[model samples]
Target: MKPHRYQGSALLLALCCSAGLFLTSPVVAEESLEQRVTRMEKLLESQGLVDLYLRLEALQQEVQMLRGEVEQHGFDMKGIKQRQRDLYLDIDRRLGQLENGRPAVSPGSPAKLPESTAPTAPREQGNPATANPGTEEKAYREAFDLLKEGRYEPARNRFTDFVVRYPNSGYADNAQYWIGEINYVTRAFEQAIVEFQKVLDNYSSSQKQADALLKIGYCHYELKNFAKAREALQAVITRFPKTTPAGLAEKRLQQLKNQGQ
Candidate 1:
């Protein structure tokens, strides 16, 4: 009976210990579980891995930054291209404007070209085969025909008109060259010199430039402007030494030297 009582007391102690372990352990575990759940929720929010709206806001910020950088890069590239184009244009203009290049002449200024100042003929009464002319070459041909036909004044008038009507035209340079030729034929050496000078000063790229220099030197020789003639003739030789103009300059310079000595 005493043994049975002690066994019962042992059973009661065991039950108490089991109950204390369960209560204390579950309470602590419950608090820890709540804290762990709260921390997981905060971490999920920070990761932006859930909730469509917050993710979209973060994605939008990234997209906007990328767009801004792309736009800025495009603007910077455009500015660099524009600057390169401007520099190229400036260099091209300078290269083309070399020796004998006349400064940009203002309109209505006294330095206004004499051929440029000549009067125009009325468009009406133009001859057949010379009529219906729309371009500079046609006009120049018509003028050359008139000059050959001994119509001196009309030819001069036509050439002057050609030069004025198409100032930058390819044939306009030829028209100026012809004016000097006409003046040389008529023995107006001073006027011939002036017209030929215009070709050299204004049309550096013209095919007739070398001829213009030759003619100008000839004009100076005719007028007995020997020093001026020597300068013009020598330039023809120096500038176009491989061409017919240079040959003519060398021959004439020798003649002038022979006359002097």
Candidate 2:
């Protein structure tokens, strides 16, 4: 009886050990599956972050390229405007030479003028009726030749002498206008204004009247006299409508508006 009881106890111990091993195997398998899923999720998140960083770098490079294009376009536009301005000035100069009956000087050639006996002396002031037409024309041409040669001081002096000696000549108004132009070009705005006013007051019937007024407005603008500039520019538009000077005044008015004046 003692041997049989011992055998039953040994059999119950072996059954309990088998059950414990079966349950523990399933729990270990589930833990390993969960760890594999977590590692996959971490790998996908890291890949997504890397892709986003690469895309952001691409966008920054595109923006830099666009900025360079815009700046290049602005420089191109400025160059075009400068060329247009130079062409306009050249055309106007050619037209002036034609109207004055003076031959255009070639770029490299020296301008020729009529011979004068008293080159340094100012001719005596006289009435146009009594003044020799040949002498008047020659004097006017000499002064214009000096201007075309870029001798501004000599041109200014010759124009002044022309005005003083041949005030009644057909070219007297033109001479006065050129004097003002020289002053304006030299940045003597106040003196230019005074000289331009002479053209308006003394030569109201001259073809240069409109241009003189236009230049006066320009001088006033340079002098920072906004009111006078506006007044003179407006007068040109009103009095010389359909003329080149009027067109120039309109352009200047637009510039003043852009400046908030």
Write candidate 1's Cα lDDT for 16-65 as tens digits: 78878645787889999999999999998877666777879999999999
Error of 1 at 83 (Å): 56
Model 2 misplaced stretches (Cα beyond 4 Å): 1-130
Window of ten residues with lowest summed lDDT in model 1: 110-119
TM-score of 2: 0.57
18-86 per-residue lDDT for model 2 (tens digits): 677545667788988999999999999999999999999999999989989989998988965764564
lDDT of each: 0.70, 0.77
Best by lDDT: 2
**Which residue pairs collide, candidate 1?**
none
- Candidate 2: 10-residue stretch with minimal lDDT: 112-121
